[model samples]
Target: MPSVLWVSLFMWSYQKLASVYPRERPLLLLRVSGEVVEVDEKLSDLPGLVNTSPYEKGWLIKVKLSNSGELNSLMDDDKYSKFCEGNH
Candidate 1:
């Protein structure tokens, strides 16, 4: 149990730190019942986020953005970081 707690703590901290980097990109959008799903690279490794946050509880997919095109329309790391920070 203590190990689990420690691992959770580490993951949370790493997520926090990772939030500072502007790399997460929304690669796919799964629409169901007029709701839009945004998928990013994080989900590629951890697909559970999709089932858990399809819209707000199950995200559908993800993509890695390298250029400043439609990606600019998406949220930046600082913005996403702040958005998540507020949730916590």
Candidate 2:
């Protein structure tokens, strides 16, 4: 069944991750096991941090970016404002 296939894939992925990453740390330490983890150690107690500083200090993950150039497509504030203005 579809559910069985998904569960199998999930289990296989977890095992693969466990092997790839050191399991000495708790599996959910950062809600993941890896070399690069962004930790907002204060978020749980102050959930508004997500709204106040989403892209800056409040980021939930700190990934080792694979392609920095992908950011070129993102609009700057003026462009984003214009785009949003047109939508409303």
Candidate 3:
């Protein structure tokens, strides 16, 4: 059931939001901001922001890295750029 529940990010996110609103609390640590920050609570009301204004008005959450070491595991601009180009 755990694996089955791991569906699309939209589904998973909506489910999480139902139980725990992202705007009410910190979802995760950014590893760059170095602080715990809240998501744009408004995202719950307007999920379309994801497709409309993904960069600016549609931002999901904010965080500061609690551990900079974890930064290495995430995609950087170049890697993400290549990934987008290759996949799409």
Candidate 4:
């Protein structure tokens, strides 16, 4: 089974929250700032969900945005898909 890891950033400081064996290099998973209200414990048990059901059950964290205005700078689903295509 593939390894799973979870991290949290608070006030620009990085911390490792959880991990399984055979860690991989750090990757930018998401960028957001706010209180992390909840985490999906299910991910630790089902890491494959990150690839299999990303839009539904694979979400990493639930954040209550500190600045709702920050969302305006983020891409919607359509724009993000295009961005990924361009980068790839």
True lDDT of residue 66, candidate 3: 55
Residue-by-residue lDDT tens digits, candidate 3, 1-88? 1111111122211113233343454243222324535556676777677557766666665544555554455555466567668867
Model-by-model lDDT, in order?
A: 0.35, 0.38, 0.45, 0.51
In model 3, pairs of residues that clash are: 31-64, 31-65, 32-65, 33-64, 34-64, 34-65, 35-64
* TM-score of predicted structure 1: 0.24
- What local lDDT score does residue 1 receive in model 4, on the 0 to 100 scale? 15
Per-residue error (Å), model 2, residue 52: 2.8
Q: 2 or 3: which has the higher lDDT? A: 3
Q: Write the residue-wise lDDT of candidate 1 on 12-39 in tens digits.
A: 2223213312345433231111222232
Which candidate gets the maximum TM-score versus the true structure? 4
Off by over 4 Å in 3: 1-36
lDDT comparing candidate 1 with the true structure: 0.35
Sort all candidates by TM-score, best to worst. 4, 3, 2, 1
lDDT of 3: 0.45
Query: What order do you get sorting by lDDT, best first?
Result: 4, 3, 2, 1
Model 4: clashing residue pairs?
none
Candidate topping lDDT: 4
Model 4: lDDT of residue 33: 53
What would you estimate as the lDDT of candidate 2? 0.38
Shift of residue 15 alpha carbon in model 4, Å: 16
